[model samples]
Target: MSEEANQIVQINSSEFSWNKKDGVFHFDGAPALLFWDNAFKIFLSTIMEISGPDASNAVFETTGFRMGLLVNDYYQNRFTIEEVIKKYSEIYSSAGWGNVTITSLYKY
Candidate 1:
C-alpha cells in the first residue's frame, strides 16, 4: 500500500473497548465481535452442507445486504459522504474484515 493509503487505513486502538465482565467488545461504542476466518468458513460450509449452495447463497446475500444497510446508516450519521467514501476501507480493515484497496472510484 502507498503511504497515503496506509495513513487512510490506520486505526487507533483506543477506539475499541473491552468489557470483560460482560464478555463483550465495543468499537466506537458499538458492540462488536472478533472471530477467526477459519471458524467463519467452517460455519459457512456447515450451512452450505445443510442448506445446499443455492439456498446458502440466498441466505448469505440477504444477510449481507441487510447488514450492509445497517452499516451504511451507522456511518452516514457519523460521517459526510466524502468522508465515508475515503474511510470505507479503513472502517472494514479496523473491524478485522481484511484490507480493502479502492483501486478505482467512479461517480455517476
Candidate 2:
C-alpha cells in the first residue's frame, strides 16, 4: 500500500468524542453523525424509487459537488492551501468516509 493508504489505516481514538446527553459525536472538534452503508444505500434507493435512476443520480451528483465546494471554502478559510491539500484525505478518512489518495496533484 502507498504511504497515504497506510496513513489512513491508522486511527487515533482521542480525536473522537461523544456527548451522550446530546446524542452527538464529534471528530476533530466538528460535529458528526454516523450512517451505516446500508442506510446510505437505502437513501439512494428511496430517491431512485421516487425520481428514477437518472434523476436520483443527478441529484446526488450535483448535491455532492456543491457540498464539496462548501467544504473547500471552510478549509480554505481556516488552513493554508498546502495544509488543506495535505489534510483533506486524512480528515475525510478519519471521519469514516473512506480513504482518498491524490495520485497526481497539480497546483495552479
lDDT of 2 by residue, 1-108 (tens): 233322112354326666665566665556667889999889889999999988988999999999989777666767887877677687768777787876666777
Best by lDDT: 1
Worst 10 residues of 1 by lDDT: 1-10
- After TM-score superposition, the amount by which residue 70's alpha carbon in candidate 1 deviates from its true location, in angstroms, is 1.0
Q: List TM-score per model, in order.
A: 0.77, 0.72
lDDT of each: 0.73, 0.71
Q: Runs in model 1 with CA error above 4 Å?
A: 1-10, 103-108
Off by over 4 Å in 2: 1-14, 106-108
lDDT of 1 by residue, 21-104 (tens): 556667766777787999999999999999998999999999999998987787778888677767767766788877787766
Top candidate on TM-score is 1
